[model samples]
Target chain A: MTILASLLKRDLGRFLPGTSSGGTMLPLLFFLAVAMLYPFAVGPNPTLLAATGGGVIWVAALLAAILPLDRLLASDVHEGFFDQWALRGISEEVVVAVRLLAHWLSFGPFIMLAALPASALVGIDGETLRIVELGLLAGTPGLAAIGIIIAAITVGLRSGGAALSGLLVIPLAVPLLIFGAGALSTGGDGGLALTAAISLLLVAIAPFAGGAAIRAAREG
Target chain B: MEPFRLAARDIACRRGDRLLFARLSLALEAGQALQVSGANGIGKSSLIRILAGLARPFDGTVERAGTIGLLDERPALDNDQPLGKALSFWTALDREAAPLEQLGIASLLDVPVRYLSTGQRKRAALARLIGQQADIWLLDEPLNGLDVDAVKLCEELVAQHCAGGGIAVIASHQRFDLPGMSTLSLAEYAL
Candidate 1:
């Protein structure tokens, strides 16, 4: 438990925005920029904004998840933190699990908060805004999971890996986007429940998959 | 001071398609040290990795009886952090206070690690290694960027570690002065 706590502390300190490790507000800023720009692009028709705004938020959230992907595992793997942790008998799986949690915590709640103003900008109804908040809560964990997995797999690719990771995540994250955004249109609990289930599955598999990916990167 | 052992049996390492070395083996008991030397690209680092259990040999096996600590090219300290805070992360985990003054890095604690020179970073890494207090130390090119005094300090540190019943396997092309330390030239095992 102490080990986990210490690891969590280190990971959070490195990842949380405004920490000494240079964790940026880039993702949050990008997310809001998307919401802010959508109205101008579509000329601010209230009915049109209300109808399509939810999907725009979903797309923005997904894109925001990509902003931090490059830094997630690459720096740690390249800089030998993983090697030292391995030497100490801290399994890659444990580190990846802690990292996944940190990754989620860094962007998840903040994006949920950002969504409030985003909903206002996009002219979403109160009931729809509530669903968007709930959907983000259910869907962002899966986004974080997908981000970590791609980051670990691409950790060895050096220069172009960041762009490639973003591309890789889009395809993998289609399900979460569909279900989470699909809930807003269908006005149903079933979509949110399915989104949460998918998130749970991805979260469960991310640590093992990411652990193996990094170990392979190390040996290769 | 606990009993520790590191041994490799008929281990062969293949990087990509080429075999770097083959039919190599060595063993170290407590209070022993070995230095692996070779030309660049001759597999000294691979052999250290094999022994450290970080990479698998193409053939044969490695056996160990203690915690392993590795210091390679990467210092592993967080680049954006002050040296003190960066080192503290590990000291906190290892639960052992490093002798920063002895490593000549006590005064460098406030410097962010990215601004540190090669020698300072090397010394900081050494502090982390000493704090780890692992039974076996696998060092790859420990003296690459050190000055005369730092080089001598590194040699003395390794000697003290061995004298205290710890094991050290150093992979370096440069001279490493440690009495009674056997040298293994990887060229002899190169295929």
Candidate 2:
């Protein structure tokens, strides 16, 4: 529908890297910074790096996802954009769903691409790199979903909200991080499938949970 | 322009442990305007939200027919974007042309929303309300941060909207003079 398209266009413009609304590049840069820093922090033990690089990448990806959570839903609720959309008969679920897509588009693919250079920085093998990319592809949607839900819940909190959202994400993201990184060590399709399944379930539940959170925020 | 109605039945509103107002009720048919006035913190804004269906009343029910539009203290525009782009975002969605020139903000389109003065932001919000073309308009403190001329312009805009068969419910402590518009003092309903 035109309304959905308009909302998506606005959300993407706000969220896409390098185009205002707090430039999503910060998260991408933070992700690569972690990868770039790991080798030096632990010394250049290629086997040690390779052995632990996959888990490091997963952890970095999870933290990087948190960087944008503060901006995701708070501004809209504060600025009354959500109320306006609701007036137009656009349900909060639809807006949250569109925002979920835009959030993923803004960082998910870029993170996957950045994983190439990150893999090199962390001393990961070619096969491990492929699995890492695949795992991120399967898991970042779950991350985005969790990000939106947390953002909605914390939209009402004034200060300490950003920190709280980051802390909250770590616990909820444990499942995705576990299965995604587990695939690298296990060298099995089972972990990837489980990661994708969790991702699918989170993505499905995010819009409704986030929608309710926004409405609750309106009351407070 | 469709036949529209907004009615609240013995609504009670509470914020936290304090009851702001109770046994408040009003009704408006098409082409009518009502102004809600009260001291600060008297729940005028809460009643507007309840009428707009954004917040549930602690008691009673609100029944309405036709779409609702609300203009509050927040402009609802992207702060980082130019005024033109931000308004265009709504224009594209609402598919209604706003009277930007009449609102005295046509020249301000190139300015970023954050740079706009308070009066200009209020004008821009009025433009957005026009673009929405909703049958019911719930304006909370619409005259805040406006000059005398801008205040008159706002009153005229609401007057014209109602003249065109829309409903306007303005919640403001400031004086809003409109011919045929009734005023509700919230203090009467306060506990």
Candidate 3:
């Protein structure tokens, strides 16, 4: 219990400052604005708009999360937090989980903010919007898991990470985007219900993969 | 009862294709301390990491006791956090140390740690060690950047930990000046 609280506090403490950090707010604000402007940017075609909004918003969310990934263990790596954490017998897996949870909190809501109004603009019906939210609910935590490891390994690397990380994660994430968008595309009888269910299944793999990746990076 | 500990024989560490240490062995009873001393690049820090379990030993074993505190060369601090909160995260520190006070950064406690100088950063970490009353202290070059007074405070803490029957393993090229505290040379531990 204390671990969980400390983990949450630590992550937020590290991540929240970026909300006000120099020049970062612009990209996220632009992301939010771009989500709002998609129909306008691509033309106000409702069917096309709704069809793409879910994917666009979720993708932006995944990207926004990337901004903080480099810092996940970067500071700790520099300062020896990871070593101390390990020495204390607090499992790295637990610390990694906590970091991801905090990442989820940091990124999850912005996803909703990006999608909520975009749904209205894209003309997604209430039901489909609900499914979009449901998919996000099931999905964003998975993003944190994926982010935890990818960020840890790549945080300290120089150059080519954008491409490397994208290549590595996109293939894995394509499924998520597919189902996530599919759920929002399903208007009634919710083909999305199945998508959402599959999301749960996929999300389970994230923590394990994330845990292993983080451990390997730290130990390796 | 003294938090019985066991490590596999040989503490091996190889990073970026360079082997830091191999087949290092050491043990400590409660109230003991061992300073892991070696020439730079010989893997004293790496040995500390392996002992702390943050790095895998490429060769031998690392027996560990209860709730070890591994101090890194740089103090792990979240600069964005308030002085109190960052210190609290370690769970080994006592609140009385007051994240900012022990480090003489009390005025800056509410401010970001990123703004502090090198010496201030070291002092802040020292305060945290005072706060965390753990069973073992594994410090890496702990005296770096500390002023004389701060060093005294740190020495006092180490003395306190050992006298309390806790254990400490410090890695440094310089002398820490505590009488009877032994040095575990990594020269033999290296491959």
What are the lDDT figures for the candidates, one per model? Answer: 0.94, 0.94, 0.68
**Per-residue accuracy of model 1 over A67-100 as CA lDDT, tens digit each:** 9998899999889999999999899999999999
Clash count for candidate 3 is 15
Off by over 4 Å in 3: A13-28, A44-67, A123-131, A152-163, A184-190, B1-13, B16-23, B91-108, B188-191
**Which is better, 1 or 3, measured by lDDT?**
1
* Per-residue lDDT of A109 in model 1: 97
Give the lDDT of residue B57 in candidate 1: 95
TM-score of chain B taken alone, candidate 3: 0.85
DockQ of 1: 0.82
What value of lDDT does candidate 3 attain over all alpha carbons?
Answer: 0.68
TM-score of chain A of each: 0.99, 0.98, 0.79
Alpha-carbon RMSD to native, per candidate: 0.9, 1.0, 3.6
lDDT of 1: 0.94
Instruction: List candidate 2 segments past 4 Å from native.
Output: none
Q: Candidate 1: list runs displaced more than 4 Å.
A: none
- Candidate 3 CAPRI grade: medium
Residues A1-220 of candidate 3 have per-residue lDDT tens digits of 7667777765675564364422135335655766776777889887787677767777776666566555566556656676566555666677776777676766676667667766776676676677778777777766666666676667445566555665566665666667666665555435455555655564565556555655666665
> Which lDDT value does model 1 have at B88?
92
